[model samples]
Target: MADLQDERPDTGHVPVGPGSLGAEDTPAAPVAGALDRAAALLAVHPVADGCNTLVWTLRQSPYHDIDTPDTGVDTDIPRLRAGGVGAQFWSLLPPSAGPHASGAADQVVSDTLDQIDVALALVRRYPDGLCLALSADDLVDARNRGRIASLLGPVSGRTLTDSLSPLRAFHTLGVRILAPGGAQWAREGLTAFGHEVVKEANRLAVLLDLAGCPPVAACRIAGASKAPAVLSNTAAAALNPHPDNVTDEVLLALRAANGLAMVTFDTARTGDSLHAVADHLDHVRAVAGPECVGLGAAFGAEPGVPRPTGLTDPSGYPRLLAELLDRGWPESDLALLTWGNALRVLRDVEFTARAAQHRRTP
Candidate 1:
C-alpha cells in the first residue's frame, strides 16, 4: 500500500521494491544493505518524527556545514525515506538575533518568514517524497501513500514577538506548534503577555513544546493551561531525579501535569552512546510511563547538536531501535517511543484548536 493517501494529489512516480527514495529514488550502493534492512522494519510499523528533524536550510549556512559532504544538496530526502520515516516535524528556525543580540525585531521576523518560505518550497519541490501534514490523520494518510508527511513548527516562541497576532499569523501559514520559553521553570514563568499567548495557543490548539527546558510552575497550573504540553528535547536530568539535572520536584510536576519528555540523540545531553540514549528513554518511561516518553532526536536539523557515536545520521535511527530492542524493550513500547505518544499529543492539540475554532465560527 502507498504511504500517502488519496486526498493528496499524487506528485509523480510510484515507489517500487525495497528502499524506494521517492521522486529522486536513488540509493547509494554502500548504504543499500542498511536501507534494505530499515525498509523491512518500517513496513511493519510507521515511523513519525516527534520533533524537528528536517532543516535542509542549515546546509546553506557557511558557519554550520553539519552534514557529511557525500550526501550532497538536500540529501536528507533519500535518507529519511530509506530510514522508514513516515512523518516529520520540520522546524522553521529563524536566523534572528535574540533580545540581547544585535539584530532588530523586524529583522528577526524577516528571517523567520524566509525560513517558512524555504520549508514551503521544499514541499513543492518534493511533492512525490513529501506532503504537508496539518493533522494526525494527514500523517497516517501520507505514510499509507508512500510519502513522508511533513509538519512545521517554530523552534522557540522567540520567533513570534510579544503578541498573539504573529502566533495566529503563523497558524494561518500552517504552523501547528510553538515552544514558549518565558514560561520556563528556572525563570519566573510566563509574563502577563506570554500567558495570553499560551492561552491563545491552547485555544488555537498550537502545541507548546518545552524543548527540554526546566518544567515551569505554570505547567502545573490547570485552567490557564492550553493544549497538552510536551518536552520535545531533553536529557535524563530534565525528567528524573538527579543532582545535575532537573530536580525531582520538577519531574513530579511534569508527571502531574500529564506532560511528556521526548528523548533526543544528542550525545552532549544524553552521554556518549546509543546505550545512553536508551538509558534516558528507559528512565523517562520508568518514571513518567510509556505515554509520556517520545522521540525528539532533532537529527539532520540541529547544526551544532552533537549526535551519539555510531549514530552518524538519519540512517542511524534503525540502529538506535535495534539497541533499544537489545535492552529488552517490548515492541509495543518501542512503537510508542518512536511515534505513538507524540501522535496522541498532536491529535489532542489539533482537536482542541479545531473545536475552539468551530465554537467561535458562529
Candidate 2:
C-alpha cells in the first residue's frame, strides 16, 4: 500500500468475451481504507505463491552462482519475509544449459535429483527463515510461525526415468506435486501409465501439474475430476497468443476438470504490464472460474527473464492484491486467489492419498 495510487498500474476494465467476470459484475469488499484493508486481508489469509524458482532467487546474491554452489551469501529469506509470502511451490529445475540438459532420461533423472538436493540444502541452511513443507498443514503451520513454507516440485516429468519407482521415490523425498512425462501421454488425454500415475497421485494426494499443456483428455480425467491438478506458469491464449498462453479449449477443459491454472508474470510469456496479468486472470475467471486462478509469477529470481511491470519481485505481491481489490474483487474471493484455493486443493489431494493408503494398509 505504498502510495499505490501513484505506483499502481492503471488496471482499466479488461473487456473479455462471454463467461468472464465483467467490470460491472466484479464486487468490491465492504472495507474502509485501502492500505489497512489490504494488510488485514493478508494477515488473515496467507499468500501462497504457486510457482517460483527460489534456487534462482538464492543465486541473485553476488556471492552465489549456478556454476558455483555455495549457500553462504543470502537474499531469499529477508526478501520473502519482507514480501509477505507465506508459502511457495519452489520448482526444482534440471539444468537446461551447459553439459547436463534434459536430453536423455538418465540425465533428466540425475539432474532433477541434484536440483532437489540443492533446493533442500538451501532450505536447511536457513531453518529459521524457511521450513520444508510436505503437506497442506505443514504449509499453514509454517506461515502461522512467520516462516516461508517451502514445497519442492519437479519442473519436468521427463526426469522420472519412465518408471513409477522414481515417482514414488520423489514423493518419499517430500514432493507432493508432479507432472508425468511424455507428449503421447496426453494424446488420449490420459495414457494408461498416466492414469495409473494419476490414480496413485490421487491415492497419495500428490498434485499433478500440467505446466501449460491444454486440459486435454488426460488433464480432463486426472486433473478435473480425480485429484488437484495445476497448470503452472502458463499463459492464456484466448487473450494473448503468446507461446505460453493455454488455448480457450484448454481453459474450458480445466474448468470442467476442476483444475487450477496459475498465471505467470514473466512478460515474455504473459506480454507486458500488470494489466496483461489482470486480463489473463479475468479471462480465466470468466471461462474457468476464479477458483481455477492462482498466481505463479515465475519470478526466476535471477536475471534474463523480464518480469511484468508493477510486479517485479516477491514484495510486489501487494500490488497485485491491491489491484484486485481496486477491481472490486471480494475479500473471500481474494483469499482464494492469494492462498485459500491452493491450500484447499492440496489438502484434498493429501486427504484422498492418505485415505487410499489407509484402505490398503490392511
Candidate 3:
C-alpha cells in the first residue's frame, strides 16, 4: 500500500478570509439571471456533495469551530448554506504513514475511530446546522429540517486491517460510505480480502466510493458489488491526466452499474476555470448520462493552493450551476446533478442492504 499522504490531497486547515467567500467571476446580465435561477433551483434541490475533507481539517485544527463564518478552511456553516449544500459526505481519512501505517493495524483502527468521533462530534455540536444521516430518508429529513445531512466515509481499504470487524464497527458508528482503497489501491487493485470487503459493504448497504480508484479496480468493484459505486471526489481523466480522475472506461462502468461520479472542483484534478469544471461535468454526462453525474466539489484545500476560478470555496456552487444553466443544461438535469442522483444511489444501497441482511450474516 502507498502512504495515505500520497493517496489524498492536503488537509491544510487555513482560515478562509470572509472576502474570499463572496468572490466570484462576474457574469453578464443574461448569465446573472441564470445565476438567480440556479440559486432558486438549488433552494429546492440542493447539492448532495459526495465528499469534503472537513473532518480531517477539523482534526488537524482542534480549535477551529466550523460554526464561525470563516473557519479558515474552504468549508463552514455559512459557506455551505451559501453553496446550497443539502447533504455532505465528510471524508474520514486515516493516517497512511507513521505508526498507523501497515502492520500497526490497531493504531490504524484507532485513528479511523478518532476521525469518526470528530465527525459525530461536529454534528452534535451544531444540531441545527448539521444532522447525522445514515440512510437516504435521513438525508432528506435533514434537508427538510434545514440542516446539512452529514454522512461519514472512511477512506482507504487498509483502514479495515484485513478484517470485516472494523467495517461493521464503523457502520455501527454511522459511516455510510467506504472508499475501500485510495490511489494506492487503484494501482494495486483489490486483494482477495479486498473483494470480501466489497461484498460485505454491499450486505451492509454501504456505498462504495471510487474517487481515487483507477479504471481496472473501479470496473472490478462495480461488477462485484451489488450496490452502485460512487466516485466520491473525482474529475474526468480524459480531460486531465490526474491519477485521481476517472477514465471514460470507469464512467461507462458507473453507468452500467447505475453508479454516480460526483465531479470534484480541485484545480489539480479538474482545471483552473469555472468552464473547466463544467467541461468535466459535461463530459461525464455525455458518457454516463446526467443521472450518473453529481457534485463532490472536494473542497478544503490547503491555504494558498490554487482553487478553480469562481469556485474558491463551498459558496461558489451557484456559479457552477449557473454556468451549466447558461450552457443550455435543463433544470431537470441540473436537479439530478445537484441532489436527486445521490439520493437515489443512497436509497438503492439501503435497499440492497436490507435484502442482503435477509440472505447473509456479517
Off by over 4 Å in 1: 1-41, 53-75, 95-103, 182-187, 217-223, 238-251, 301-305, 358-362
lDDT of each residue in 1-362, candidate 2, tens digit only: 22222322222222111222233433332233544566567766757888877664553343453222223321244434434568888887644511223366677677667777777887787778789998889988997787788888844555543467777788888777776534334434666766666676677667887773443553465443366677767778877777557777777766776677888887877766766787777787788788888878776454445666655655455556766777788888878877887887788777777777866431
Lowest summed lDDT window (length 10), candidate 3: 1-10
Is 1 or 3 the stronger prediction by lDDT?
3
TM-score of 3: 0.89
Question: Candidate 2, which ten residues in sequence have the lowest lDDT sum?
Answer: 10-19
Model 1 TM-score relative to the real fold: 0.77
Model 1: weakest 10-residue lDDT segment is: 4-13
Alpha-carbon RMSD of each model:
7.6, 7.8, 7.0
| Model 2: residue 18 alpha-carbon error in angstroms | 35
Q: How accurate is candidate 3 locally (lDDT)?
A: 0.78
How does model 2 fare in lDDT? 0.64
lDDT per residue for candidate 3 within 284-308, as digits (tens), equals 9999999999998878554666778
What shift in Å separates residue 98 of candidate 2 from its native position after superposition?
Answer: 15
Per-candidate Cα lDDT values, in order, are 0.60, 0.64, 0.78
